[model samples]
Every structure is written in structure tokens, then in C-alpha cells.
Target: MRLRPPTNMVDPRAKRYWMAGEAISNGVVTLVLGLLAFLIEPARPWLLLALGVALLIGIPYMIIMPIWRFRVHRWEITEDAVYTRSGWLWQEWRIAPMSRIQTVDTKRGPLEQAYRLSRVTVTTASAAGPLTIKGLDHEVAADLAEKLTEVTQANRGDAT
Candidate 1:
């Protein structure tokens, strides 16, 4: 299936941030491996060289795969429900009917703050069951949370 973001929702910086984060994380791993190789003498040179090459190859792989996979992430909003599709290993899709939504929360962390992004979490009646959608513009996240809350409340005739 060719999954795509909603036409009305656009996150132009998602891929850039995703790739940058992967690069930073991979750099850290490479640094740790380099240090370990330096401390161990027996295979030090070979290990260091191998790790250097691996880091070079892995960096592109890490950045490209996630961004490509995320390009396939999609969500659709209908009159009474929202549908989401995501996953690299075990692809799956979920539909959350407005009537079944108990609450919606918008969250942002330090990194997300730097990126000006936020995550929206939707809670349902199932115990401890919540769906989290991330990498959204902060304002859009808040608006989505508000819209979800309004829809849920309208369906139930009660505010949560």
C-alpha cells in the first residue's frame, strides 16, 4: 500500500529532523566504539577500521530507511473516526471512532521543543490503551487534540 500523510496535514521538517537525530545517535555510537577499540590492543586497528567503515555505511542506512518508512505513514480522518497506518516490521492500521475516544492529550518535550513539534495521544475505553501520533507541528498538535476532544465529547454528550 502507498501510505501518505493527510492532504491537510503537512510536516515539511519531519524527514530532516528524523535524519539529523539518526546521525547524532549514530555518531555517539561510533564514538563509543572507537573509544573501546582504542582501549583494546589485540584487534585495535582492525576493529577501529571496521567500525569506521561500518559507521559510514550505517549512517546512511539509518537515516534513509526511517525517513522512507515514515514517508509511508498515513492517517485519515472521516466524519466519525480517524484511521492511522504505521509500522516497518509489522505493518498495521487502526481506526479510532470518535465515540470511542475518551481523551486526547498534546505533549512536547525538550527535543520536540527544539524542533517545534509535538505528539498527540488519544485514549480509548480500553484500559491503558492509547494511540500516540508524533512529529506534528506544535499548533497542529494542539488543534488536533482539541478537535478530538470536541468530537469525543459531542459523541458522548459529556465533557472529559
Candidate 2:
């Protein structure tokens, strides 16, 4: 049987981090718009009604999308290559062979660091650019980076 990408999801805690981030961002946007609506509500009561409706719909979507993303994002390091799949509305899949990989970089932003999460970027010598796997547990990202480095070096006959 031939297996495909999206073999596994990000760490479970990743869902919480992603949801929290989404909620905060969306909440900010909603707040800004709501404030704007408040400024205009005296002139346009209908606009206030519209804004209320939009917020009612948008807030749920903002919360739901992170859960959907958590379900969708996945990655696996096979013996031959790395396989990744992620998207909510549109799906993206990436495959990077161990032999072609030049570097594996891991990064953590303030939010990610707070959540103990990191993103790993796998760069190859192709014009397609590097592939990034986000929201991994920090230790897992580090270990995966190390493993990928080993794989790349082994492919070059330098790991022994």
C-alpha cells in the first residue's frame, strides 16, 4: 500500500495556541470595526445592525477556523522525504527529499515561544522555496531539525 502526506497532525497543544491567536486577532478586528460602527451608528442605525450581524457570524468563524486548521495541518518525515499538508479553504502539500535538503531551520516567535511551539523550515536547492511546518512542539521541532540534518548529511555520505 502506498501512503500519502498528511500522515499526522501538529501537537495537540498547537490547537489551543492557534485558536487563541485566531481569537485575539479576530477580536481585535471586530473591536475596531465595532468602534467604527459606534461612531457611525447615530448616522446609520442599519450599519450598526449590519455590524452586529457580521460580528455574530464572524466571531464563530474565527474560532472555528483554528480548529479546522488544527485538523488539517499535518506533517511526516518519511525515510525518503518530508511530507506535509496544510490548509483550510485551500490545501497545500509539500514534498522535500532528504537528498535535496540543504538546511532545516527552526524558529519561534513570541507567541509561539509562549506556547512552547516552533516552526521548522526545510530548504532545498529548488526554486520552489523552502517548506515550513508550523506549530510544532519546540522539542519536537528541534529533534526533527536534528534528524533532518542527519538525513541530509547521510545522503551526502558525511553522516558516518
Candidate 3:
């Protein structure tokens, strides 16, 4: 029997980052709608309905998705490839072969840095281009980046 790679969830802090991002996006939409409701006197009531709908959708989404995504988002690195599983509802799994890996880059945005989180993106020769693993602790992300870089280099050298 062929065994698949085991899954590993991202850092818990990632939930905070996801929640913050979702909040900002929903807040912006709510703010813009609020402004329109106030400015357009005739459309005030209908826009208020829009505002209501936003709350109904945004509130539950903001609360549930971060937690749920945190639970489901996972990755596993084996000798041959890095396997990633992600999605809120429709889950996906992708395997990036170590031999085909072209680059391993780590990024830390302002918000992510504030939460001591970082993301690692692995670019491969395959058509998938790049696969990113988000919500890792900064140190973990850096170490993974370094390790993946070394492995890819060695794997490619062996091919020549």
C-alpha cells in the first residue's frame, strides 16, 4: 500500500493573522456601504439592507473562517516533496517535488511581523509556479526556507 504524507497544521498564531485580515476586509466594505447610505438620501433604506446583509455574512465569516481554516490548513515535507493541504470548504492538496523546486522565499508583511508570523513560498519548475505556506512562526519559516533551499540545491546537483 502506498502511504500519503502526514498532514501538519500551521502555527496557532496564524489564526490571529487570518482573523485580522478578514476583519480589515469586511470592515472596509462595511465602511464604504455606510458612507453611501448616509450620502445617498433616497437609497438610504435599501443601502441599509445592504449593510444588514454585510453584517449577516461578514460577522459569521469573520468569526468562523479563521478558526476553521486554522484547523484545516496543513503541510508536510517529505524527502521527495512538500505536501500542502488548504481550503476553507473545498480542500486541496498539492505536492511540490524537491527536485523541481526552483526557489524558497520567505516573506514577512507588517501585520504578519506584528504577530511574529511569516510565510514561505516555494517556486518550482512545474506549471503550478509557486506554492505558499502561510502562518508559520518567523523562526520556523526561516529555518524551513534554509532547509528547503539546501535540499533543492543538492537534489539538482545530483541530477547533473
Pick the TM-score winner. Answer: 3
| Clashing residue pairs in candidate 3 (N, C-alpha, C atoms within 3 angstroms) | none
Candidate 2 stretches greater than 4 Å from native: 1-5, 39-50, 157-160
Models 1 onward score TM values of: 0.79, 0.82, 0.90
> Comparing candidate 1 with candidate 3, which one achieves the higher TM-score?
3
Candidate 1 ranges beyond 4 A from true positions: 1-10, 49-57, 127-129, 157-160
Overall local distance difference test of candidate 1: 0.73
Model 3 ranges with Cα > 4 A deviation: 1-5, 157-160
Q: Give the TM-score of candidate 2.
A: 0.82
The worst-scoring run of ten residues by lDDT in candidate 3 lies at: 151-160
Per-residue accuracy of model 1 over 1-160 as CA lDDT, tens digit each: 7745544433656566666677777788788888889788898988788888888888877767667757655566677877776665567666777878887898877767778888788877776567777678888888888888777777854323
- Model 3 whole-model lDDT (C-alpha atoms): 0.86
Sort all candidates by lDDT, best to worst: 3, 2, 1
Model 1 sits at a Cα RMSD from the real structure of 3.4
Worst 10 residues of 1 by lDDT: 3-12
**Residue 139, candidate 1: how far off, in angstroms?**
0.8
